[model samples]
Target: MGDDQDIGYAVTAEFYDLLQAETDRRQARRRFAEPAARARQAILDVGAGTGIVTGILLTASAVPVHAVEPSAPMRAALLTRLAALGADQRARVTLHPEPIEETGLVRAVDLAIASNVVATLPPPVRRATWQAVARALTPGGVLLFDPPPETLPGGRETAARLGPVRVGPDLYSAELTLEPERGILRSVFTYRVERDGVLQREEREAFDLWPVEPALLRAELEAAGLHVVQAPHADLVAARRTAS
Candidate 1:
């Protein structure tokens, strides 16, 4: 979603983590940490939004990591998070302030993870990113990515509440809608802040979601010199680098 812009994690990073707090990332990192620990080289965290996954890898494994983040607001939040960690943890990470494709690394890592990002990008961007990520992995390196949803990007967000939180006397909330489409889905996010049940502020952000077919996606990754696997019950697309 970094087509010269942040992934519309709007309000300038104010309510990002709050709305995303529903997930227990600590528990979720188990599968990832296992593979990351066995990696023979550095790890890569593509679209390291706010460094959530990056932090998990740092604390769970001894391996060093390269974190590539392109959004200014998200990177600010990410740097803040990393700055508060121990010196050793900080030293183990190299920050790439650009998109993964533009990061200029070659077969540099043995494991990479792209979560909640790739499916939002259009075909061209996604293809370029896959090729670049494939080139950046060491032989047999594993790339674990989140596959797109059954619905188009913006189509899946419904009026259902995505996440809501209360801080002090203020409360923040957001909702999502998702549907299906062949072209890009323009999802709209509306946020409202309430102070003591009184409406304080309201804002809206637009995000573009792309559609990806599994067959085509698998072919693309295979053509890029990687063997692809989609877990039937999981929302994951795992690709391992193959022999040249």
Candidate 2:
């Protein structure tokens, strides 16, 4: 689950361009359709893995973006992408070499997003991260993010795509588990992938599980002083800070 760092620079790096191509269309639409026409001037993207979301922000809108990412490889890829863009677009991105929870970006932004990023965090961390997102924005700033279906019981079944996993210097056979009852599915087997001797990647994700209903997510947001704006799918949740 924490392998976001590796995926950004290590394994996903080679396929970064391909990945970006596949996601560009959808992100462009979201960028343009995001509500609140006030036109966010400053934005922050948490869990900005490989900066795929970052690239979308740059291409879809003219707003300045601050991307917070922890993976060393992903940050480099993000920088590479920025360098590839037109001079004006390139200047709009400011990279933060840290995770959302740790980022101390001083600017108060109008919007904050932590897309596919939050699903990978542990529960407590997820809550804390959301709190941080709320604190980082100006009054009434919006927070948009998506939680994987595994966040709801019976949702983990969708994560059955099994592939090799990598761990440290040692490699072992592993399998991905789909625990529908837990509303989460994650890598269950040993950390081993083909080619790579020691596993360099491992995933162990747990969401609210069955006992915690998906609607509870909204309650959590409110507890943090944010209100639900829209959640079009089980995979997406968007909210706005309550007016002060």
Candidate 3:
């Protein structure tokens, strides 16, 4: 039942997929597809923004997918995407308009994924989410997620430009500021829409994220009854439920 007030995804939802097109494409191929294909039973897609990963999971396998998204706009986009899929794929998905901490999964899942979602949560919320995920997973079930790098600068500083990404007529520019003491990383994104080489509209959105160290995250997961394992990918962390 988490609201979108703090996350700011509602403001960015319209342009999110377009803004992160390249990164999403690469991750769909390199990260999501394989793990989804390996799922034998149910799979839970946490923070299923715009259904990018949810669509990938649907196409990769026939396993029932529970897609949890907290942002209303993002969930709307996800439902639209689901409607466009084949009937069989659509039938295999269940959309949950709630955060992972309140997943309300009917049954335990064999695999759960939360790409780029962990760092966005505050510390207490993050811990509660991990515990909830553990409870939703079957014993030995796998969980995969990517946390931000531990080296992220910690300090109050003016916004620093990250870079610009473009997809056709849409352009997105990113800037970041860090408040290390609070474990919050704030990112500001500016989206510009242009058609026929004329400026149309520009929008700005911001998000706050908390980055935890690998060791700290590992300890947290272990305390939640999960066995943490470093995945082959540097940014990815894979954990398995060790107890029922």
Candidate 4:
């Protein structure tokens, strides 16, 4: 979502929204809605790709949001979506075009959400991110992200593939081939957009993803002054800022 991982997202960002099901989006909305409602100060969205999850946070609560997105294309799309919001909502969002470290951080945020961006974070970046998240959050502030299930290294032929969404006259598909090497999941994403049973456009891009150990992740957060807590949902990992 930032300078560390934009290379793989270039091609994928175009068809990102298309690949997600309506049910998936709705479920995601419901999952974060509670924290958004409870947030009094503000919410932070790290790697806010195309603002799908960010929009959910905005609509779920009447509070300001810090949308940190480093990918230009995705950020542009995010800006496009934010442009359609009512003036009040529009005024509440501050777009950070850089990584969390380089941005003007707010230390009183009530919640921070990182959707699909967590597992892909390299160890070095993840450490920096956890430290930054700790610094930005208010006491008892919440941080929720995916409990990324580890994937074994595999070739495209044997890798897990998802999508092939039908969109009126066209169809979209994405294949994720993971190569976990050098402490990163080198993901080769193959995207194919076709129409009327004809292959139209195909793109392949490599995304670097780093594995996360829950125990280690917990230790890291604790070191950063945050505590892993019971998640609102069974699928997410929730951490709260311990009172200083």
Candidate 5:
């Protein structure tokens, strides 16, 4: 809906884990593991917010995992989780404090996973980001990503028609009553972020879903000189870069 904004360090820092409450976080990561086992060895998880996929990447295989998350708060949470697992060093993990678009990784990795993060981006930026992914990957390295549905990024028209929906914490659930009669899909993101033992924030960022259709996503990957081995769905895109 707008130019690519950084989303600031604070917001993105804790964004990864928060998204799990709404999106199918586990299945998305599992999708990466099921088809390709060898690709798991050296992974670059783009948009590795708070390490949700980071956690999966570690447990799913005996591979080295590098997570590039632009949000400082999210990195803090990821570090905390990493420390909890006693993986401060042996985990073969590197957490980059930058967005995937800004990262300049040279060696081709076995896999690159960009979850729901890419779908919301405007077309040009998305193209540029995917191109970066392709360049950083080896030929045949899988590129997986998933965009959100029409329920995000301020798709108010659909929300309004969908009517009321409740979401959030066990006790404090956020409620939304859409009036799609006026073309709006109302929703609420109820999540909290804690940084370095400090509870920093609580907020809801609404979405009017700007879904990137699966067909279009596949076409985009192919256009970028990559093979679309699998289409996007439930926040997953399985693809590979073409051989030069």
Candidate 6:
């Protein structure tokens, strides 16, 4: 995660699960179930926010998982989520509080996954992150992820929506701005907490996302000695480490 994304997640962490909802979990599980089921050994989950996909991977298999998350608040939530699982399931996971590029993981994994995470990284960090992921994988290991489309409308101001979600005593809303020239999406999220129908507190956070082009991403993966393939899921890409 970039600094901006970290800030955004920190502010919204309290209500992140509410925003994601059960439907989001179901869809993610459907998308990742096959790959998770195929894992015969260790797996790594990059930017494993709130442990949604991490939980899915655990459910699919008892493989050991290393979950890397950058934001402190998100990691807190992830830990809480993991604690709710069975002891065996919880024991299978190891949490790292570092971004993918900087995570000091010495063990090679059989599979690695990053879901909706690469797009939020700055260019230099994004490339370095991919290289780190490649380094973490064993030869012939697979990497699966979805990068945002390059064709997203560039210069647009999306309408802001207020109170689109109500999570317990809090309400959430977001405003988005897209700058195609910079390949960045800027977002401002608002959180309002109320008690007894009285507003008690309100907070706002900003995030910047840089979505990489598919062609450029493919080139980077190849440069890292991985063979890339477009996965069945829309916008999803799978890359395999080539034998040295």
Residue lDDT tens for model 6, 25-132: 897788788888888888999989889989998998768999998788888889999989999999999898777777766446888988878777777877787788
Candidate 3 off by > 4 Å: 154-182, 195-199
- Per-residue lDDT of 104 in model 2: 69
Q: What's the true lDDT of residue 199 in model 4?
A: 94
Against the reference, the lDDT scores of all candidates come to 0.78, 0.61, 0.77, 0.81, 0.60, 0.77
Q: Give the runs in model 1 whose Cα sits over 4 Å from its true position.
A: 1-12, 22-31, 151-160, 179-182, 230-233
Better of 3 and 5 by lDDT: 3
Give per-residue CA lDDT, model 1, range 1-244, as digits (tens): 4644556564637777777733636533854777677777889999888888888888877888999888777888889989999999999999998888888999899998887777677888888888999989998888997777544443354755755588888898876555455567666677888998898998877666776777888888888888985442265779989978
- lDDT (C-alpha) at residue 63 in model 5: 70
All models, RMSD in angstroms: 2.5, 6.8, 3.1, 2.3, 6.7, 3.0
Best-performing candidate as measured by lDDT:
4
Tens-digit lDDT track of model 4 for 113-172: 988777777677787888888888998898999865465455333365667888889888
TM-score-based ranking: 1, 4, 3, 6, 5, 2
* Model 5 alpha-carbon drift over 4 Å, by segment: 1-5, 8-25, 88-90, 148-170, 175-202, 207-209, 231-235
TM-score of each: 0.90, 0.69, 0.86, 0.90, 0.70, 0.86
lDDT of 3: 0.77
Give the Cα-based TM-score of candidate 5 against the true structure: 0.70
Q: Which has the better lDDT: candidate 2, or candidate 3?
A: 3
Residue 206 lDDT in model 1?
68
